[model samples]
Target chain A: MKSVVVNNISKRYGSKKAVTTALRGISFEVDKGELFGIIGPDGAGKTSLFRILTTLLLAEEGTATVDGLDVVKAYKAIRQRVGYMPGRFSLYQDLTVKENLDFFATIFNTSVEENYDLIKDIYSQIEPFKDRKAGKLSGGMKQKLALSCALIHRPSVLFLDEPTTGVDAVSRKEFWEMLRKLKEQQITILVSTPYMDEASLCDKVALIQSGKILSIDTPEGVVRSFGKKIIAVKSSNMLNLLADLKKTELLEDAYPFGEYHHAVLKNESNEHELKNYLQQKGYPFEIKGTDPNIEDCFMALMKN
Target chain B: MRTLKFLLQKEFRQIFRDPSILRIIFIMPVIQLIVLPWAADYEIKNIKLAVIDHDRSDYSRSLTNKITASGYFILTDYTSSFEQTLGEIEHDKADIILEIPASFEKDLVKESESKLFMAVNAINGVKAGLGSSYLRSIIQDYNREVRTEWIQFPRFSPETSIEVTNSNWFNPSMNYKVFMVPGILVLLLTMVGSNLTAINIVKEKEIGTIEQINVTPVKKFHFILGKLIPFWVLGLLVFTIGFGIAWIVYGIYPAGSFLTIYLFAAVYLLAVLGLGLLISTYANNQQQAMLISFFLMMIFVLMGGLYTSIDSMPGWAQAITKANPVSYFIEVIRMVVLKGSGLADIKYQLLTILGFAVLLNGWAVVNYHKRS
Candidate 1:
């Protein structure tokens, strides 16, 4: 079953003098129990799409639905069935961890004791400091408490928007692990993130740019579609290396990636020709042919 | 119903947990209701009388004694120099000066009609008007005594001199504190209700928690009432504490039914809280909400007729007050407390307030949407 369906949705803001289009004809779907990701950088309309899906904002065009229910017509039912954690930490900062949890539970007509089993793993991490105000907590602890609150009602479809944006690497890893556990419980998850690395963790990822979806595929599928030969090169002069690589007519693109620069080659070029051209420049270098990663594919799709 | 109960519980816990709001809610009302009435008094007293007695006759002395003994004015300085008295007026030392002309006793004995020169400092208009009027009344009584002594009355003596007895019906002595205590009580309830309600909703918006709540199944009206009813209960609690403080400090007991006062207060508080919610819906943050609430409060309190009488206002201002929820409550509280006006007498005011309650709350609910 399609747990979520968004078709050609567009959203714009501001008046005629200056208009900002946050989402442009975006279309995607999340199957039952599948974890889907909308991956992009900031200002790439990730937040806008999440807001439209969660029913917090109206899309200028297109239609969306949760389960079999329409987003606009069945908003009340959709609210009960869906959990949305916005990009910003939207919890009551003045409320303590325990109070905030219980409050959300009670408002949903359940109590913390009843949902203790569902959120025990996440909530127990912060339960030791449950009396502390949420504002005073560290960023990672707040993320845990917020996720616990979002799950207290056991929403059928969870919408987590940039959940690990400010979290440290250790907590970010643990948070993705928690999502993996949630996925085993057969809950459909639609998560958006500006972090490209987190995209691989989702079953399927949609790379969006400037309110437009660049590509939608599995991480491997996106990488397979790069359609270019590439080589990772390291030179003694890393800064001057990119200019020299771009200066070569045999290369299509050369951009820095981590410790080395990944250089895309034209069809006629060979590794020996590239290496010999760089060595004649009086620089010590090493070159090895490599696989195209999602980042490379994203840059390729973004250019088009 | 259960959702609202949980919301109210959360709100009350937050209200109690914040020490700053606790001081504003519980402690501030008691101090204001007890202390504000004394400072807001309208009764004028302690007029400084500078008696420049140019005539050193027995009648002049008698007139001076009567003015001093009236308990309104104090004999500040009994100087004979007119220049000294003028210097006193300039220095703000004396408010009234009495100068009796030379041979004033002989003029009254021979000429039955005599004139007394009186110089009054009229800068503080209420003090000056009241002081002069009190002095004139005392002088007239002395004049009647002198005339009565010269010629005896026919049968009734001083009793039949066309005695114009004045009776103050509601407030026997026309106590300014009695009139003011009720008015200030209305003001205290309104300030607490409207401000807390406005800031409560806007604080949620500022903290971005309103979006979280909006995504819930909570209805708009339920959300509004859940946020507002806690303040409503707190407003009534403040009213109760204020009523007790008024009785303890000022010894003022509402002459009418307590039910009537609470009845009007309940409706009036709903209307004011409704207005606050409407403002919160339009305001984007707590600072904007505070500014808007204060803007409405200044207009409501000043024109609510707490210090100024509505009858003396211009036609347009009076018409505005008719739509003012604060003024309706202020008038009802005073009428119920000071005049013992019952529900039957104030039914019109109660109905107007009920109308405002429905209208403002309905508008607020309609304007509040989960989607921005």
Candidate 2:
């Protein structure tokens, strides 16, 4: 069943003369218990769309429903069904970690002891410093506490907006693992992040840019339809390699990818022939065929 | 109900954990309750006196001695001429000058009536009026003494027979401190409660915790009420400490039931906490919230009759004070503490504060948004 369905939602700030289109004709859906992801760079309207879904902001046009309740008309009901962890850590800093969790549970008309099982996994990591003020917790501990608080009431659908942006690599890995476990509890989750590596972890991914979705599909499906053979070639002079490849007639698209150059050539170009041509040009380099990952697919999609 | 309990618990924990905030909350009220009463007195003392004794008679000397012995006045200088006394008044060195005409003693014995010119500086009309009244009463008593010794009159004079008995109600001594301590306590509660709550919410907005709450199954009303409940209880707790100090140190216990004072204080706290929430809803950060709340609180406390009696103000000014919640709380507290008034005496104030609490919280909950 479709747990969340957003259709043609648009949001604009200020009047027409100076309006900022934060969300533009965006539409998507999440199935029951599916871990969906919105992958995009900063300022790509991820936060705005999350706000609309959480019922904190109303879309200017179209509609969104969370767990069969309308986003605007059924905001009160939606608030009770959805758990939202915004991009920033907004828990009461003055309150202790334990107090923060207790406060959130009470707001949902529940208790920490009642929902202890749900938050135990994440909350236990930060439990040692539960008495410490939320303001004093490390970035990773704060993320854990925030996630634990959001899950206290056991909402059906959880919306996490860039939950691991500032966290360390180990904590980020730990947080994603926690999400996978949460998926087992049969809770639908919609998470947004800027990290391409993290995108592969989600059941489905939506590549967004400039308030528009470039593509949405499973990580492998998006990579399978990358539609071009990619080549990585490096030379002793890397800058010269990029400038030289862009000037080549066979190369359709070429840009620097990490330490090597990822070059997408015309379909008709032969790999052996291209290597010979570069060899003749005295380009001391190693060339190899490369499989497309989500980052590669996103870059390809963004080009169009 | 559970939400309120949880919120109150969270508020108490927050207040207890922050030592600086706790100190400000508890110590501030006790210091203010003790110090403000002494500072906010209307009783004028140490008045500078300049005397120009033209007669320089033994009677005039005796009258000057009496004036000096009054203790209320400080005999700054003895002026030989009227011009010298006028110079002293012009220079602000003297508040009042007693001018005795020549042959003043002879006039008292022969003419039986002599006009004594008393020049009082009336720039501060209230103080000048009081000083003049004191001087007149002293002269009248001296004249009565002289008349009694010279004449073979009856023991009871007509003025003495028709005596006017005065009674000071509530605070019989008219102790300015007694009235001020309660008002200052109100001021402290409003400042600490409102500003602290305002900063708390705004800090969440700044740091992104509010977004986490928005995504939860927590209702907006629950979230808001949860947040305000803690601050409300803290305000009341602070008010209780203030009341305790008033009773212990100042011997100013409430005339009514202590429970009534606390119950009413709880309602008043809601109005104040709602105001803080309202401000936090509009503010994007802690600094902005603190600034706006500070400004609003200054206006509320100043106009709340903490320093002056609202009833004594002009009709229009008094009308303006009616809208201020602080004014009603101060009035109600004073009535309960000094007069021991019951519910009927403070019913109007109670209802008005309840109305303010509802309106402010309604506005806060409505304006409070989860989205940026």
Candidate 3:
């Protein structure tokens, strides 16, 4: 069953003469208990779409529903069913960790003990600092507490907007692990992030840019859609390798990978011919055939 | 109802934890109510008098004695000449110089009239005007005394005189502090109610906590009520402190029942607090919220019938007070306190203020959106 569905939703801001479109003809869905990721750069309409799903904002056109309830018509019911963690750390900074939890639980007409089992793994890590004001918590600890509060009410679908954006690598890894555990509990989770490496962790991922969805598929499916032979190459003059490759016009796109550069070839160009051209140019380099990653796929899609 | 309880608990905890609320509510009222009445006093006294008694007659000496006996004037100098008295005024030593001309008793008895000159320093107009008026009344009283003593023909005496006695009802002594105490109490309640709640919601918005709450199942009115109740209770507590200070320091006790004053205050707080909430809804940050709160408070305080009577205000200002919740409370508070007015006497003011409460709070609830 579809746990969340959005259909061609659009939104714009500012006055008549100066309106800027934030989202345009966006449509997607998340199945029951499926961990879905909306991957994009900043200003990709991720926050706008999350707000629409959480019933905190209304779309200018089209419709959205959460758990079989319309986002606009059944907002009050949707609010009770879903939890939203905004792009910012939205907990009361002046409040302590324990107080923030208790407050969210009470508003949902539940007690912390009632749902202690759901958030025990996450909350226990921050339990020692329960008396500390949330404003004083570290970035990683704050995210943990925010997630604990978001889950305290046992929401069926959790909408987390950039939950791991500013977190450290270790905490980001632990947070994803927590989400996987949550998936085991049969909870549907929809998240948005700018981190390309994190995109592979979701059951399904949608590559969005400039308020439009470029593609939506599983991790391997998106990499497969790149559909061109690519090579990772590095040379002594690493800085000039990117500029020299682009001038050849023999490749579709060239981007700097960490230690090397990933280059995709055009349909007519062969790897043997490209190697001969590189040797003749006196640019001694090591090159090997490689599999495409999501970042490469997103760059390829954005070019067209 | 359960949501309100939880929200209110969090609000009260935050409020009490922050020491500023305690200072703004408790210490502020006690200091303002105790010291403001004494500072804002309009009763003019301590006038310095310079008497140039050229006549040196019995009547001139008696007039000077009468002026000093009134306690309004202090005999600062007995100048030998009017020029010396003018010098006294120029140095600010004397406020007025009373010149009893060298007529002896000859002009009043023979010519039936005598002109007395009074040279007054007009720099501080209110003091000078009051001093001159007091001197005139005393001299008139002395005229009546001399007339009755010298011309004691019963049938020929003045029969057309009309005596006008001022009772200055309720406050027969007409103490200005009695007038200011109640108005200052209303002002204290207004400042605490408007500024605090305005900053409360905007602070949440500034820190992004409002986003968390907006995404919840809490109703709009429930959120507003949660914000209002804690401050409402605090406003009442401060008001009680102000009332106690008024009595302890100024000896001003309400002649009317406490219930009547509370009735107006309860509704007045709703109106002012609702206004604060409405301002917070539109403000994007704490600085913007603070500015808007001050903008409204300046209007409310200046036009609230606190410093001046609404009747004496310009026609346009009087029209604006129809919608001003502050004016209604100021009027009702004074009525109940000074005149011992009953509920029936203040029914119109009470009903109008109740309407203002509903209108402003209703606007606040309606305008406060969970979305952009």
Q: TM-scores of the models, in the given order?
A: 0.87, 0.80, 0.87
lDDT of 3 at A175: 95
Interface RMSD of each: 0.9, 2.5, 0.9
Query: Candidate 3 — what's its lDDT?
Result: 0.89
Q: Is candidate 1 or candidate 2 better by TM-score?
A: 1
Cα deviation at A172, candidate 1, in Å, is: 0.8
Tell me what TM-score chain A of model 2 achieves: 0.95
Each model: TM-score of chain B?
0.91, 0.89, 0.86
DockQ of each: 0.68, 0.46, 0.65
Give stretches of model 2 more than 4 Å off: A15-17, A74-77, A94-133, A152-155, A180-186, A224-256, A260-293, B1-8, B48-68, B75-165, B188-207, B220-236, B254-284, B362-372
Candidate 2 structure quality by residue, lDDT tens digits, B1-372 = 676666567666766777988788778887888887887778878888898888889899998888889888889888669898899999999999988899899999899998789899999897799898888888998898888779887676545466689999999998877788888888888887789888877876787766766655555776787787677767888888888898898888888888788888888889888888899989989889978987887778778998766788899988888888899988988888899988888888999999999999899988986654
lDDT of 3 by residue, B97-137 (tens): 99888994668777867878888999999888888998899
Reference contacts recovered by each candidate, as fractions?
0.87, 0.80, 0.87
Question: Model 2 fnat?
Answer: 0.80
lDDT of 1 by residue, B1-372 (tens): 888888888888889889999898778878777678777877677999998878888988888988888889999989789999989999999999899888788899998988887789998988888889888888889988998899876775646346488999889988888888888888888888888888989989988899999888888878988888898999999899988888888899999989999989998999989988888889999889989988888999889999899899999999998878889888889899988999999999999999998998899998998996
lDDT of 2 at B110: 97
Q: What lDDT does the true structure give each of the candidates?
A: 0.89, 0.86, 0.89
User: Higher-lDDT candidate among 2 and 3?
Assistant: 3
